[model samples]
Target: MPPMRKWTINGDFLTLSPNGVARYGREVTLAIDDLLAAGGPLADGLEVTLATPVGGHDLPLRHIRTVHVPEFRRPRLPQVWVQLQLPRHVQGGLLSFCNLAPVAVSRQIVCMHDAHTWLMPESYDRMFRLAHRVIMPVLGRRARAVATVSHHARRQLAALGVAREDRIAVAWNGCDHALRWRASRSPRDYRNRRPFVLCIGRNQPYKNMELIWAMAPALAARGVEVLVAGEAGGAGALRHGPNVVALGRISDDELAAAMEAALCFVFPTRIEGFGLPAAEAMARGCPVIASTADALMEVCGDAAIHVDPDDVNGWTAAVIRLLENPFERLAMVAAGRARARLFTWRGVAETWLGLMAAADGVPVQAPGGRGAASAAPIVAGA
Candidate 1:
């Protein structure tokens, strides 16, 4: 009989990149590790370790055990590392949070965040787009279970042509990090007297960075500044109008300061697995103006001023309206904070571990919806 599956997580994403996907892996893993240390009902019979290739990045592994596979340290083709090498090295069940899971592992769980490559093909490299198209469907089909960050993503997963679409279930991401890192003790001492609008995250194609830039001219006319922050592919790459200040890769505290000081937070992304920045901004009590498409609608819900991403006029109008109307902005802030309170790291860890256990053939004792921590229902304010 196949050695009674020992639980292991694919840790390649941790070492390879520190993108949004990798950050999710770290945040959720740490939260789970903390819960396991606390020794709850969910901890029983759960023997999970992070099986990883060697890398420079170090995680706070206080409660998490990690096994280093030395051969995988020097990187080769990532697919080969995952498909062939990882499976050969790791024994027992696998829980892969970042998209791909080894096909050879019969009992495994993979988190399919979104059908991004399908939704925005131009965003990725040619080789990556081709590989994802070929690989994702197979990963979805063969894996014992697939989890997505949002309910909206499950619908997108259906388009991937996976046979077991029924296995696609909701395992949402958390925004507690926003709470932890939010501007504290006087909103980071806002120095700017001018009212500003905030936009965060990288200048990726799907992010619709140009739309944020495009709004600058109109926003400047109304005496509002646009503070664009995040990985702009390196300094000096982005061009903004007279009103825009492109802050590249700011500290969380700085981001929080920006959010707290802003008149409104804008996210005009064409697509997202979950629009984390909007959620992050909401958690900070910043008024948000975000796109209605994909996961943003599910995430922001009634809290934000929703706009069609392609409608430049609509986006401008939303910002203009929010900045001018204090009642609307205050309403968004109150609703947004209440909405953000719904997603917690502790809840995320509980839900994910419950799902992982079920996937690994362990009997799950958690509640039906989104696992144990979800018992505290997300009560959105009116």
Candidate 2:
């Protein structure tokens, strides 16, 4: 009886590395580690499908199940297909299950990263949006429990009537080993030979880069150049010639180096369920400047400079103020580090344990005062 497997991990996401590199890929590949770190009966019986190109080479052969499917395709169709197949292959063998994508299965748990499909419909093709909209609601209704990365996402899911409030759980994201490794390096050597403010993520419209670009003159006034990392989604080259250093796609170490050297991390996104890069920068002790979305505030706490993403003048003014005020910048950096300390993989694992236990009809303790210490601090004048 498969040695009473408590969890079976899907690793197809890791297999498509070149594509993963293209897409703003992060945690989908690290799901196995997250499962292992929870430290329960589940860890001992963990089994994973070996598909990651580089990492899979050394994994034990007996553990791998070669699910023959095209590993790469446009719009992540291959992953979608494989995720759909996992339910049948692992059905009856597990006491609990977790999928990173929408799937039909039992004793199931799924973590949907964001509802960007609704926010930025133009970023994806109609077919992709249709598939997601049609399938996710069904997946939400069928799953035993649902997990998300932010409270804003929880509210969005509830408003959509996607799932019951109790069934939906919030598991904040973590800063992985990569960021930690970079944190140990020298700031001058790591970041380019100049002081700059960093902005990370896809240069898509909903991310509100246009607003950031408009604020560039203001950022330049503070003697801080704006550096952007990640792919540019839409056509026609982005503006801000010499003032902005556009590092299109870079290695993990390079990204880490950039974050470490940054004067501050700025992210004035119009919408996001969880702000990964902003939180990551804070975890590495860099102050963050982001929009005042409920989700952004929730993740950043009192450690960030908040701005109205749509208000061009306001965003510009905030960037300029942070750059000029050395004392305020240092204070925010210290506060950001403290705020980031509260979010860790261990905490996320505990939240998952409680949610999964509740789903399994196990009498789990309620989340009383669990994350109270880390809730966002109040800002003066709203």
Q: What lDDT tens digits, residue by residue, belong to model 2 across residues 1-382?
A: 4453344334444444433221222343244355555446534444434333223223223433434334334555544544555455553222122224535565666666567677688867787778667766776787767777777888887777767777777776655443445434432354445568778757566787777677777667666677777775222334564467676776656666777778778887888777777777887777787888778888887778787777777766666666678798788878877777766655565666565556545565765332235555534324
Question: Model 1: clashing residue pairs?
Answer: none
Taken over the whole model, the C-alpha lDDT of each candidate is 0.76, 0.61
Highest-scoring model, TM-score: 1
Model 1 Cα shift for residue 373 (angstroms): 15
RMSD (Cα, Å) of model 2:
4.7
Give the TM-scores of the predictions, in the order they appear.
0.88, 0.79
How would you encode candidate 1's per-residue C-alpha lDDT over 264-308 as one tens digit per residue?
Answer: 898889888887888889998898888867578788777787887
Could you tell me the lDDT of residue 313 within candidate 2? 78
For all predictions, the C-alpha RMSD in Å is 4.3, 4.7
